[model samples]
Target: MGYKNLKVSIIGIGRVGLPLALFLENLGCKVVGIDKDSEILRDVRKKKMSFDEPGCAALLKKTKMTISPSIQSGVRGSDYIIITVGTPLYNHIESDLSYIKSVCTDLCGSLKGGQTIILRSTVAPGTTSYLKNFVEDNTSLKIGKNFGLAFCPERLAENQAIEELGLLPQIIGTEDNFSKNMTNKLFNLFGVELLFTNYLSAELIKLFNNVHRFTDFAVANQFSVIAEKYNQNIYEIINMANKNYPRGHIPSPGLTAGTCLRKDFGLLNESSSAPDLFLSAWKINEHMPFHLVNSAKKYTKIRGKTIAVLGYGFKKNSDDIRDSLVPKLLRYIEREVPKKVLLCEPNIPKKNIEGFKNTDLNSCLKKADIIFIAINHDAFNKETILGKIKKNAWCVDLWNVLGQKQLVLRYN
Candidate 1:
């Protein structure tokens, strides 16, 4: 039951699982990362990363942990079994619990009596409780008696996963004290404060965090539209309003999206009785992709012009594309039938995105007739972009965050 000499198996070795596995290994635990994607396992074993994140590349290089695709070989006889699979949004918008339930069902087959299984994936409000029942029924073993089950929400942002894992307070809850204590001890090894609560409360905490962030962005996005009507930029206005002003903190307006931000909204809506605000925020964020496309067409016909989407990843320094507005913007622009579309995301590898000409910053700057700054990566400066872009070529700064945070509202 002690931290050292513990065996931890993390199911689903994507962004969340990989870092968690590495952290556990750093804590002197023997870690095994199991995923069905052989490509991910190959990249991980070879120290070749599929995407870029803060502190991920260096950590992957030095990791001596076991990574495999076979669940029996990876998870069997483990002291702790952790599920970090996704609850992705499907049909454009709805909680698809396929991955979570599938992972749980598979995990039940590999469960060792007395081993602890932690739910670290974001889920609907009652999912943690439901998992306890599902595992008991499937395994024919009592959850609290035969094994420990805890819902420990994974709260780290993609780019800041490593730092935040140690810095941010972790939320964990279980039916019995044994699982609760085990989760706390495990997270404590990561150098974080444990915020213990009930199972459903912990699950809701994760969903609520995602809901609030997107809703706040929706408010900022609405302000952006209103500012445009008055020949003003909302980013500047928000900055000016928040200048040393108490209770004036507001997130900047931009492409409001991400896998968690948009997907969790569906889970929130399904779980909550009053989902009006959540639904509204989703609608507003959903409209933003088409909004950028329509705004860009106001300049010239795109039928034969080459368009360069400067950044397509969900956010700056992130390679996750789940529910990102950049792809939606691309889909909408495809209807406009541009001569060609070039995706210019230096952080994202070319293999992740298909069909589009994924090129470097230099090539995109030279070839584009219309340039849309979809994401505000640190590398792109407004002056530097202006220096690179062809004069008289249209620039549609959707995030309005090229050289600076404010986008000039005057679009002509």
Candidate 2:
């Protein structure tokens, strides 16, 4: 089929699926986004993006892609069906496959011969094999002969999804040669390199990639705690160590909880044996907010002080707050019984920061007796924001965005 005639139905037009839909639509594919969220469908109909993703807003404004709430309608005549629904972790640190299971069951009615079903969500190992059997059991279709089934994991970063979708190599994992070739043809339209593997390996690849990053971030967070105990600057020490050495490129410390990093480690450790390294990393990263609050308490009293929390987003410049550590930080701050709390997150929409006393950067900085640069957004420029802060305000900057000598700084 020609690229223009390639009908692609994307289930769950969320952060992952929306970007992919926009990119494929822009790539001359007939794209249709399937989302059960009425709010999301309404926003898509008005050409309004619900989240921050560079390069997708403009494409959404002029795109001809269809957005639908009905799974049957979305999958009726599409050549490719991509599942991008969320697979969140439960409180017990296990992968919750409820969303995935629901989608797969819904898809059985619409699944037909000659159509390729691709699971693009991050799932546990053996999920693809399970899905293949589920579909075969529900319908009379044979996997390799009648329809194609593949596990094509989405490896895009949140803010860079648009750019990375077309640039990053697509990984396709299939059980049969027929499914492999069909998936290859579909993703090859992106003009990126394609790596083909099996279902278990591909699933492990996604989890391993995220777990590696989670552990790497934990190392920095652990060092930050160690440096604070010694009354030394972790950022400065890292810079000194990595200045001329190729082997010593250590990342600086910050709150390191995001949707993928926070949950994927648990997903990997779900079935693994005890003495889990990922769990150790999780402990170190999860304790960062408490560490920040405790570290600040030593120098200044948080009780009855106006405190400003700058930037609530998990990542630096993105507005995605799922699994962000900011909420945990806010909870810690609340326990301290501050006189007033002001939240300032430039990237997040004001509507999203509800139930909190939200304010602009200037006002937040001017009124606060204590400040925490909770997220190191690029907009929190040290040169500019430093001028507006109260001279004697006790600032806790774990990211060290403000070139302060230490984590806790009290400007005179």
Candidate 3:
């Protein structure tokens, strides 16, 4: 059957699920968006997105999608059920499948024959196979013969989900041709080509995709630390080296905190046969926050110091706080028991700093003795911050985002 004639139900409308539902709805497919969190569902029901994702809120207003809190009810009679739930880490390492298992429990009761279930969450390599086993064990229906199952792990960047969903090459892995054809038609409507593979291979693709990105960031961050030891600028060296060289361009060093990079690095170490390189990279990236804290100690005394963290979000131009490293810095600062901690994120409202004093730019500049640029938000760039900051205050630029100045310490 053609995809336009399909009805799709998306579970867990946090980041990926919300946009996926809207995109499918935009393609003239009847869509149902389900989540266990009623609060999130209420927000999405009113076209309110909690995070900053491009084109989500705008398209949400125009889409004809059913937003529900019950997975069993929402997924009924749908041709496809797409799972986009969280697979957060346990003990900061292993996959916590409680969320996915609960979702399976809710979905297995309402699942019908000839319907396809898509696993879009990033999981350990054997998770899709686990899902296949879980469904068959719980329900009377067989997986491939009576029903269909496929794994199409999400690969979109946080802010660019809408565009990347339509542009990036999709990987759909299944055990049989029935599941493959059904999954292919689902993505074909989005104008994205599907690269077919087995279940474990598709899972590894996402696992390695993110883990390697973490390793790449780790390499640059290690170099940045080395440069700082010599009291030199790593950004200048990185820029001159990559001016026109196209063989292998390295990413800039910053707090490598996001939902995927660190979480998937842990997953990769657990899943990979040879995990020496992955473990080493993980150690470098994991120690970055402490490294910044130690560097901050050099310029100013942490005890009884007023430190201002510029942005709370991990990525630039995006307000997603999932696995953000600002809190890690804050945790370290809290250990020192500083006089005051000021948070200034213009993107986030003054009232929403979460019990901390939400001060304006001018206030943060005036009160803070040391300022740390945790995220290179355009709101707090050198263009906007240079004249505002007090000359006596020390600024730590983790991303080399500041101009040359005595007080402005461009942290490697």
Sorting all predicted structures by TM-score, with the top scorer first, yields: 2, 3, 1
Residue 330, model 3: Cα distance from true site in angstroms: 1.3
Clash counts for the predictions, in order? 1, 0, 0
Which candidate should be chosen as best, given lDDT against the real structure? 2
- What are the candidates' C-alpha RMSDs? 2.4, 1.2, 2.3
State model 3's lDDT.
0.84
Give the per-residue lDDT of model 1 (tens digit) for 1-412: 5568788999988889998887788778889999999899889989876766677788788888888787777888788888888787677546788887887777778777888889898988888878888888898678767788999989888888888887898888888877876776677787777888998888889989989999999988878777866867676788888899998888777798888888888887775566498888988888877777776666577788888887877887677777678888889888998999888877766744756667888788788888888888886766657677766667777566563444422222
**Over the stretch 297-379, how does candidate 2's per-residue lDDT look in tens digits?**
99999999999999888889988888889889989999999999999988976744857756889999899999999998998
TM-score for each of the candidates: 0.92, 0.98, 0.94
Name the runs in model 2 displaced over 4 angstroms. Answer: none
Model 2 weakest 10-residue run by lDDT = 349-358
Alpha-carbon runs more than 4 Å astray in model 1: 272-275, 299-303, 403-412
